[model samples]
Target chain A: MSEKSPEELYAERVKRVLDVAALRVPDRVPVFGPYQLYPYTFAGVSFKDAMNDYALAREACHKFQDYFQPDLDFGPILAYPAPAMEMLDIKWFRWAGHGLGDHVMYQYIESENMTADEYDEFLYDPSHFMMSKWLPRSFPPLAGLAGWPAVRTFMWFGWTGGYVGLAAPEVQEALRNAAAAGEELGRWFDSIGQYADETKAKGNPQAYAGFDWPPFDIIGDTLRGTREILADMRRRPDKLHDALEIATKIFVEYGSGAAGAELPLCWIWMHKGTRNFMSDAQFGEFYWPYLRKGMLALIDQGIIPVVYCEADVESRLEHFADVPPGKVIYHVSTTDMVKAKSVLGGIATIAGNVPNVMLLSGTPDDVREYCKNLIDTVGKGGGFIMDAAVMLDEAKPENLKAMIDFTKEYGVYQ
Target chain B: MKEQLVSAIADMREEEALQLAQQMLDAGEDPQAVLDAGKEAMTVVGDRYEDGEYFLPELIIAGDMLKAIGDMVKPMLQAQASQTEPLGKIVLGTVAGDIHDLGKDVVGFMLDISNFEVHDLGVDVPPEKFIQAIQEVNPEVVGLSGFLTLAFDQMRVTIEAIKEAGLRDSVKIMIGGAIMDDSAAQYIGADAYGPDATAAVKLAKSWTGGK
Candidate 1:
């Protein structure tokens, strides 16, 4: 018999993932390897070099896939373009070779990019707010955009005067810097795109086609900052609701548009809305409605929404039952897998719960034992994916190998 | 009035809490009483937090209320010259190479409200800095905080440095973060691991024999 081609393998892996998403039993439970800088570490490549050199980053990612061979490939997506971010002077992230040591992973710096009183302005004209206010605050190189006239002003005779702002020397410089950054981003995307194609050709499917955040997180994480947004819930609940409403629509469009049929998954990193961050009532009121709406919208577009619950979301599992059966996957971090399976068992696909600390600090035997238990319980029938509780940055190499190899071996269906 | 103040703060009535605090000071109430009431309200907030009724937002706003009330009464309390001794001194920091500090800050705030003098060394604190702070402050308890996986080694290294400096036995060490647990605490050679700020306060209080 002729051996299966890479295309066939790719199709098989994709089907395995989608089968779990649709709550059907697959040939075996798929294992997802979600690591940010582990590949660089494993390949003996410095994060600084990878972020600066796209080719080296791609090599490191390919090397990692060649070794682990998990069903889904992460590619070099987390190896952010440090030079482009530097040129733009983006304040949201501090990457390697910039503010952090060359070996360190990038860390997000959160602050209130938008003040409390600006909700009205943001709600009224988000584009102007982003260009004139948010962008300038987030990226210092774009500070000149603050002086540019509102886009709405460019009507009939206003268009002639509106073009005047573009002629400003600082604004011109900002445009040049932005264009240069865009070109840098284009190069980075091209490299990542090539890596994805190569990995697909090698029989590995990429995890997510696009990424998104819940509207509440978009406000809490990027706009008002976590503390400020939470306070806003008490101080200005009405305005917060209005802002979330706007964000929901914007995110749905952004999420669906970015994802394609080639890989029909939109990854949403849920930062807040956990039990420690808010009450179940608060989550229901401020967080869940819009998130459910966004997920349903993405599903309407035939894209599966993969929500990575970052923190302990055990108490909030019941709320996820609202999603359409077999349409969404909850990649939980600190949630109890037993409870998750019972609650979301046939309702939605569940993945993860392996303690990252175990992978980092435990022995290979410990990792293997834990994986066996997870496979026995969470991976009982079907509709579950094996993964670390959180993205791995530092881990014991032997332990990671044990997790992947053990899960693949013992997670077979009868 | 004190019950009103407590309930106002505990219920997260930020504006009303501040107004009530200001009103009490204007009425010439003993500054210590207002401070005591703020502490009492914080305990209620902490209890709710432990019970999972209140979360980060409630804790933050409660801390803010206490700070405002402290500001209002500090000068007056100083003029009276009747400040009580703090329960204990605790050195705290988010360990080296990890800059995430939301959890650390919350722990610091809770410790401060719990009446421990917290010497927060801020984020990305190296082992040498921790040893230096340990020597300088001579704190009763040291809390190491980090939210990332890399922090495990850093925490172990920091504890080792503390031991090398001959200060390990002098202080009861505790580790706290989202990723921390008893096993990690054991691995890092800490006396205990607190999952949240409340747990940190409890550990500190137990170590110092404070009520």
Candidate 2:
């Protein structure tokens, strides 16, 4: 492995990810994860510091890459800008020292920023409603948006009076802070970009090729709270469907617009479609149609959609058969791996079942045993990517070291 | 007529359920009988949820339908004045430092439909608030809810505060949410943990000595 050139290693790593993504056998199973804020923890930097200090955040990524050296890298980890969150006074996220200790990981506050009664307004003009309604509600700094009707009036025949709102002292101060935050965020991204380059130079291909999500989840996760959306499902199924239609259009437009005609190995974060969240009937009615629309949108653009199901999705297995074979990948955490293999073996690549909880608490021997079982079973038909069930926030570094080590040694195909 | 009311609720016909409930009351049917029918409808809802015939929407709609019936029946029941003891009283909240409340809301709604008097403290509730609510309401069970892993510590802190306040022995403590499990329950010194809302209801029922 050490004899190979960096370019060769980069090509081989990308090939492993793409090969498994296409339901074909690579030389061995690829190991990757959605590691957010974890590298910061691994590098002994508080997430608060990492968010504010681009160098610290980049260093964390470098440290993690150097220590574990997995087949693929989830780049730019821990890029959340502290200044921006503080400037917005955002209620959506709780970073260290906000509501938690300096070392505690960031927590997303999922509340009802959008109530049930606002479906028509949101569906009619999602962009307008999001800017005027959703943003104002989610972020306190943006609450002054009511003072600026330029957004509501369609730029008001190109008038300059709308600038009056920004002249407000608080709004001006907020804008200044926001400009500073944007600069910090840009620097942070640049650091991540540099890290990505360094990882490639070292032969580790960045794993998160791109990101997308299911439409229903896009709304349910960010717009309306879970309870609100579920209640809306029964109370106003028609209005819910109407909103879903708009969301599908918006997601597809955004996904295609950002990626152009094709994207490489797009990661579709799947939530609220799993078995525990909904029944098969509801999954079909409310979740699947819109999800399929978005997935097909990406698939039509020749992008491989690697959908990472957030939780167990045993009952929703048969729905994957509707999608074209080898066009998509299913990544799961708690769903039965063998069942996933049986259901999606030929039609799509099946990745993951490694429990994050076990990694945090289990021994290296346990990690090796589990990886061997997964590679032997789900890895059998050459359509499996060995991965943890969820994003790796914090794990016993040795256990992760053991997992990739075991897979590389044992997961090779003849 | 009562059977029809049950069917309307069981079938998740919200408006129909409300109408049938009102009609039953207007026809001078016992208000207790109307409440019993509503409760039975929730039983069916719970059963369907477990059996996979229903989803969260069904549970929410049924809870709304029952609340509508409850609004009508509760007034008449007050006039009739039987003064029966409630099945149990539960004080619930998302633990301090965590704001996720979807699971807590589901559990609260389920307990409400099942006839448990519930006091929901909403999200980001400090341990002191749980202690204060416990003192004010003297509930049979205290439920700590959160989804973040950090809430595990908050649960332990809250349970410790309850114990420190000398109320631990008087009430059962149950922790639940997306991140909680039996081991979390044990780690936090909670009496039990509910994997989901249905399991929470069953745990509450068992603690209250109710069927």
Candidate 3:
């Protein structure tokens, strides 16, 4: 047989993943590169350099792709622009060289960015609330935004006085800071886009186009925080439900809008709805309804929702069975993959069960054995994508090579 | 009243639990009795967590209720000049280069309520800081918490530092976090690994010779 071109290889790879997504047995199980900071580490790039230098980040990503050659390319999206974060003075995360060691990956610092009693205000006008409340509290450079008038008041005659708020010197300075940070972000996105195009040209398609969060996580992770939002579940159940309802609409729109026609997949990282985060009953009440709604909305847009279950979600597997067949992908961490296959197989694509700890600490033979077991079970008869349980950062090179190479060789379907 | 307080806390009626505790104290009840009821309620919460009836949210709210009630009754208890000793002393902190505190704080709260004097060194604690805390606190048990993969090395490094300081034998160390398991525990040279805060409390209880 003649050697296939990159275009042929790319088309075949995309078909393999899409076929698996639709519950058909593809040529072989797709192996996603379980990388977040691992590429930088593999390429000998410091976390500080990766975050600050977009070109270096792109090089690191390319290095990983050329070496490992996984079916899907892990893009440079996780390498956030340190310059933009510095300009915005964001409090949500502390990246390397800013608030951490030069080699340390960025860590999210969760706090109560929104108060409990302000749910009504947030539900009333999320745009205004974000501008006047959330943004100011999260971004110190945007503290002047707190002085701005309600965004809704900027219409008609209200514009005369509303424009006065924007004229304030601090607000102007805030606008300048925002503009500068936005420009830096645009450069970062350009760097990522360039990497995506380059990888695609080399027959390696990116896994997902963009990312979103469940409505409950949007409130819990970014707005009210893990502790505060969980407290709100008991303190003000009604208000919490109302806020989730509002957040559901916003996220559905945001998620569907982020997907492109070429790669219609939106990644949603499920954080607070895991097994130990809440009771199953609480998940039913506050989490599943809206998460299902968001997933269905994206499905309606012909976009696939790749839900990454962060912790053991064995208890919540039944809740996921409600989704449409073959339209969602559940990439899980600590979830029982055999049970996940039994519950979600043929209904939705199931991916991941490889332990991150094993990859980081175990031997290559251990990784091969684990992957062989997973292929025999979860990867049986297709509809499974092989990936690590979590986003890998510091993994042994031999173990990672074992996971990828073993999955590709052993995951063939008859 | 004590039964009502316990049920209120266990049932997650935060306002009622706080109000009921204040009412009991106002009625000239023993502050220790009120504190004991709070502890009993936490025991219920911990049991529910073990049975999977409760989770992090319940633990947090229950912890907050106990802390609030304790804040209210502590001064009064001090006035009476009667205080019981803690079960044991524990030095706890999230190891170096990791800032994740939700799990660490949950473990700390569980340890605190279980009657361990927890000298919480907070997040991103270096090896030297752990050594300093161990020397100052002289705890019977030490807990090292880390949520990221990078923490495995840090935990090992911190344990080595403790060993270098010649305090390794003085304290029994147990590590807990999301990514931790028995293998990690062995790799980090800790005495044990607790999967959750409840298990952590159990480990502390077993090590300190407390029920």
- TM-score per candidate for chain A alone: 0.97, 0.92, 0.97
Question: Which ranges of candidate 3 are over 4 A from the true structure?
Answer: A258-260, B78-81
Interface RMSD, one decimal, each candidate: 1.3, 2.9, 1.4
Candidate 3 interface RMSD, angstroms, 1 decimal: 1.4
lDDT of 1 by residue, B48-79 (tens): 88788888878878877888888888888756
Please give the TM-score for the first chain of candidate 2. Answer: 0.92
Which candidate number would show the highest DockQ if scored against the true structure? Answer: 3
| Candidate 3 per-residue lDDT over residues A295-383, each given as its tens digit | 89889888888898777788899999999898988886778899998988889988887787788888999999999999998888898
Q: List the TM-score for candidate 3's chain B.
A: 0.92
CAPRI class of candidate 2: acceptable
- Model 2 stretches astray by more than 4 angstroms: A115-117, A147-181, A257-263, B1-4, B19-34, B68-97, B111-146, B149-194, B202-211
Candidate 1 chain A least-lDDT 10 residues: A256-265
Per-model TM-score, in order, reads 0.97, 0.85, 0.96
* B71 Cα displacement, candidate 1 (Å): 3.2
| Model 1: per-residue Cα lDDT over A1-414, one tens digit each | 029788888998899888888889998988985688899999999999999999999999999898888889989999998889889988988878788888888998889999998999999998899888888899999998888788798998998988997798988887888899999999999999999999998988998888899999988898899889987878899999999999999889879864566668888989887657788989999999999999898998889999988777888998988888999999878788999889998899898967888888899999999889988888988989999988888788888888888888899898
